[model samples]
Target: MSIMALTPPPIPRDGPLLRVDRLRQWFSSGGFMSPRLTVRAVEDVTFEIGRGEILGLVGESGSGKSTLGRAVLRVTDLTDGRVVFDGQDVSTLSKRQLRPLRARMQMIFQDPFASLNPRMTVGQIVGAPLRIQNPGISRSEVEARVGDALRTVGLADSHAERYPHEFSGGQRQRIGIARAFVLAPDFLVADEPVSALDVSIQAQVVNLLMEIKRKLDLTILFISHDLAVVGHVCDRVAVMYLGRIVEIADTRTLFRNPRHPYTEALFSAVPVADPSRRRQRILLKGDLPSPLAPPSGCAFRTRCRYAIPACAEAVPPLAHIGGGHQKACIRDDLALQPAC
Candidate 1:
């Protein structure tokens, strides 16, 4: 059976299902006085996922989306800020205190093959969490729950005795999903769940996620670079860049009218189906900045077409722009092109 990197915990019945306040996750290297460098993977990010909300986190590679996910789950400790899950402060919880709560929070890793234990049977993989959290549970009960979870993910019962190596990529991912859902977790962090799958398989998995969310009443943090997938499955979207969120709004609002320059650039790249509506790609100037030493003031100022002298003076706050839409860019006069 696969083991979690760190045991997680649970929360209360009210408030935003998950509230992240000024969360920062930083890692330092060179302990032996080699001019230690710290990678600011997640810096002062704040967001909320209400009950049964699938909040999509969209960003380019190395933008710190995964790190933020792990930190929110307390799979890794945070360097600063607070993470409140279900009203409880998971960041302050100890391992012993977190273990029982682990059953309530789960993670769906990006690589289906790597996340599962190749040597273990599917039943073992799915039943592991129930056994760990409920050590007193009967063997038959574990088997029953495992079977149900497998069925829910569209796998047959006989396949439970088989190993992950015996399945296709999609089936392996289904097994991973079975394992994640077996615990009936209240909150899930699905990190690039469908990225490794084919286009067709991606739809199947995404549909499965939507169905399961309805069945489980789950609150999810759906992290992906695929804006199309995010648009289809997410209620709201938050765009991340250089370890910070640049824009956040309801899916329709953000897709129809992105306020941040980075968001506008990102949306412009997404392929539109209709030939009549070709989006002019807003090609970015350079690669992502190094997380170790990010640019000053506006991290995106170097590439932003609307950047000015004041942009390099201080970091722009993620401020409300009206009607629940929020943006980090300081300029409010420039009109951004609508991608779709």
Candidate 2:
């Protein structure tokens, strides 16, 4: 491996909204101490989000994107590593200490219909977090705050009185968004926020989120498998494969000049409008290996066309190519090219 300069400006920690470092979350199936088999849901992932910036996490179904998002939120137990939010290490925080931090960090799950409580009205759903965080707030104040939150997500105050089933899918998702933002959290982990909506409504929700981020000065970690969707709202993008980050760069740089073979394959999958023009699709071979027994070197090497013998001997560390771009592939000759 050759050493290259990592000169991109490091994420400012002075007041970063969120910082995750070498986070690893593993699940044990059944293994003796000798072999130590475990499913690495998230392994050695690191990134940062500025006060109001959106950091997109993109990957295939089992690439551990959602796991990383949940891990940072401390919703799931991490096997090891640190997650610092607003300068506090969440992993080490006691339940009592973590409770206070919940007021500043929240999550918006992927499924709108499923995430909402069918038994509760919209107001109750949105106001639950507020009540838990600040019990001293009056009932009248809770209603007022719930109204404001509903209005913020494009819903009327009266809508809060109705049940979630009464609303459409997009509208339910809006309620979910309202619930997450109701607490006025500084950081939010939005896992596939738009993937479940209609294509037309997807833009509406995404635009709403972008607007909310700007207006409220909120920081977000947007997780999605849709590259185009991620590119639309994220300031920077991180591409994951088999529980590890293979490439990360600014949104424009990642889309226009992806530097990882896996990232290139993902870009090629995005559908285009014109039927007359066709692009060569790079077909990857083999299924993604189980994280418990992932390949010795690069996790993607099993399906990578440029894989060499050296790729099997040692894992490739993330190396800077240029700008803020970084990749973990060994084959320089197979550097990623843009989609035509």
Candidate 3:
């Protein structure tokens, strides 16, 4: 069997690369122009990614997946929570203090075009961090390092002289990857890295990322709204809804035997290549509730077909079923066995 097919099934507590606990980020609208409401971008969300593991974060656009990723990296402030990286808390770092530690964690943003500066050459863009981090390093060493990073991401050393707009979408993303990886970051946060690329090009980028992971022995947090892509690259998957993680499991387990209603709905919505063999897609009713005014208990209850009256009254804690599989659902009677 292929490595994708033969790998042992994922269990929740097997191990974690990064651990997040009760994370919350609340933004209060200010002034008369604002609604004077608090937008809870992330609320009491928790999960972990095993070392050298690809833990996919999947959710709808407003589901707070990106926000959670940013918060963990301490790119944004947190309202309440703890982000433990290799057992060290990241939330406690001061601006001046986070410098040395910043080298270990890096992010690949969704919009490659926007993330890169048009004014700077690719070499300068990639080498800038190195310049700041290691001022004493010689110019020749920086040039060599930048060239090596470009080659690692499959771009030629010559391409380092070009600007971001000069390359194709896929190539630009590769540049982003090159910039992020040049630092040799231990944990990489890819926020929808492939979502902006052409469908034909997505696979190439995905494969490149996978290859780099193996060669570099790096751990990654691959965030995306597409289940298909997540299935391809991630070892485990976490499904988020309305600022909270509704369910999380091994990648295969999530696809084959989704335990939570939200996860099941997601799988049901995926379109199959063959129209004749299509399973009925679960169409969620009503739009996602506004984060400023989320439902009291289960945020998904308003749209969940299996939601009960009690679901509206009590928030379901993520209860452990067995074998590290967990779900936040009151209806244990309907839980599906995790995929093997």
Top candidate when judged by lDDT against the true structure: 1
Which model scores highest in TM-score? Answer: 1
Name the 10 consecutive residues with the lowest summed lDDT in model 3.
Answer: 331-340
Scored against the true structure, residue 22 in model 3 reaches a CA lDDT of 94
| Pairs of residues clashing in candidate 2 | none
Candidate 3: count the clashes: 2
Per-residue lDDT of candidate 2, residues 225-250 (tens digit): 98888877889999999999999999
For model 1, how does the per-residue alpha-carbon lDDT over 58-118 read when each residue is reduced to its tens digit?
9999999999999998888789999998778888788898897788888898999899988
Q: What is the TM-score of each candidate against the true structure?
A: 0.95, 0.92, 0.92
Give candidate 3 regions above 4 Å deviation.
1-15, 31-35, 274-278, 335-340
Candidate 3 local lDDT, 47-118, one digit each (tens): 888889999999999999999989999988789989888777888788778888788889998988899999
Clashes of each: 1, 0, 2
RMSD of 3: 7.4
**Predictions in order: lDDT:** 0.91, 0.88, 0.87
Please give the TM-score that candidate 3 achieves against the real structure.
0.92
Question: Candidate 2 overall Cα lDDT vs. reference?
Answer: 0.88
* lDDT computed for candidate 1: 0.91
Clashing pairs in 1: 12-86
